[model samples]
Target: MNHAIFEKNSLILLIGTLIVVSIGGIVEIAPLFMIQSTIEKVEGMRPYSPLELAGRDIYVREGCYNCHSQMIRSLRDEIERYGHYSLAAESMYDHPFQWGSKRTGPDLARVGGKYSNDWHVEHMRSPRAVVSASIMPGYPFLAQTPLKAEHIEEQMRTLRIVGVPYTDEQIENAQADLLAQVSPEAPGGAEMQKRYPNAVFADSPSKAGVTEEDALVAYLQHLGVSVDFKLYDDKANIR
Candidate 1:
């Protein structure tokens, strides 16, 4: 236990340092074992549908998280500006959650149903069209680009392996669901509705083919529709 003895012996000092670090690690990590008990369960939260998932991918690919945060901090200012402060249960199904640290644009945690599809379209095609002062870049190419429907099932399967809870039937019908979300004639709209009860589906644009814009808009529209905040009891959710 002599400090001088340990300091004089480098090997013993290394062992002692390891012991201290191990204890610190255990002290910090042991509380996580009770994480399940700490988390409050909200009933309506569901996994993303295929099209929504695709749109999330596009959002990530385009680095939307750099500007728009999906997390709303539980503070008076954030709560007033962004409706309800974001709940942990709302993003329980997200793999690597979109709790971005910066807000170059606005918080999109509750942007769902806030604007019409046409508005979203116009905004995507030209952000300045909707918000005259918007400095955001336009993504007009998304409107012309066709959706990559071929790999929708594969994406769902990959997400399933990572605790997304995508069922076999859902995975099997992923492409169908993606198509149904964007195109009227596409099969599985009813089944998609049944599978993801509150899932959002946008009307197809005037373009004949399903475009990336359809996927992105559908994803954006479904942002905060899962839980009905009107019935959400804050007291019951307090841990």
Candidate 2:
């Protein structure tokens, strides 16, 4: 065998490896940018509240990212299975986005207000009660532990730094937004009334449990509530 022929073959192999790696990188990243073009059409998108942001951080820190993805791609099976594919703007505020590829559990991009506080507590305590045959372990610690509210402002600051639009002016508006959507007949509404039946203060902030602190619960409870197959198409109506 010629030594020059062997050297030439090695160079060819190195070039091939670089080409393959480059293609793979582009394949993985290109779609995300394309998806950004579509996000311009999404409506009613907003930043997570301080407490909800805290809960999301907790969700991530607990390795919940290992099991769930925050992204819902545009696809028939994903729409049919998960209710609606997520929009690009939906997760625009997330740093290093939680759009995981592998889902050991479920998609939580829209898990807001899907269940009750008690249910979250219960599910965290024991998954089997809420989800029969769930392989996931219970997070009893989150329930026994009262959530630390110290980082409320700091968390909001972090979200704002990233891109969340929450501001001091928006707090009152957020409360009004929740009130308009929430039905007085709803289970949580009744509980809210029992506590702060009337607006005692024009801008004093809703009761401790009725505002953003509890908005985290509202977010967790409202998951999968927006997409109603009977109401609208899951895909963006953007031209």
Candidate 3:
């Protein structure tokens, strides 16, 4: 019953600790299975297209997550500042998830469609040029660096293995989609649309071919624009 008794008998202490820990873990984890079903279903929540996924990789590679957070807390200020509060379904397909902890810059959860592609290109090239008071470093190299997407198919296959929902057709056309997103006039526009119905195809003037800037911009433009919150009751989905 006392600490001395448990310490005196190692076997008994081990057994008793395991029993206590198991009970505590079950108490915490058992309800998750049931509660998962009760999560509110929202419309327009779709997985990131191959192009967006590639851009996401570039985002992570550049340590953008170090300054920005993708998750917006369910708070009054956050909702007012960054549209509706973040939803679980918004990041359902994110492998490691980019719900960062720091806020050196503003939250980028709802940054998609918040600015034009040209504006983003300018900002990335020279953050101070766009925002005089900005402290973020410029990424001019992204525009100059050509995007390498030869392994895009393999990347999609790997993501699919990890629950990203990439289909065979999507994997097959990953390179084409990546090119088409940044080059709207490209020949694969039709194929890209067929594979990713919700994708945005636009011309990026930063590069003749696909550039790192194009990929990063594509990923940034997709931050929190997936779900259409207009149809949902904002008051009801605050949590």
Best by lDDT: 1
lDDT by residue (tens digit), candidate 1, 101-197: 8999999999999998889999999999889999999999998888786887887788788877889988888877887877545677888889988
TM-score of each: 0.83, 0.60, 0.83
Minimum summed lDDT over a 10-residue window in model 1 is located at 230-239
Kindly indicate the candidate among 2 and 3 with the higher lDDT.
Answer: 3
Estimate every model's Cα lDDT from 0 to 1: 0.85, 0.56, 0.81
Show model 2 residue runs off by greater than 4 Å.
1-38, 170-219, 222-239
Locate the minimum summed-lDDT window of 10 residues in model 2.
Answer: 196-205
**Global lDDT for candidate 3?**
0.81
| Cα distance off (Å), candidate 3, residue 219 | 0.8
* lDDT of model 3, residue 109: 96
lDDT of 2 by residue, 1-239 (tens): 55665477988768877999999999998888867454554444446544345555666677777888877777776766766667565666676577887899888876655555656656767889999988899776554454455545655666677666766644433344344323343234433333322211112123333332233344454344433434446356523
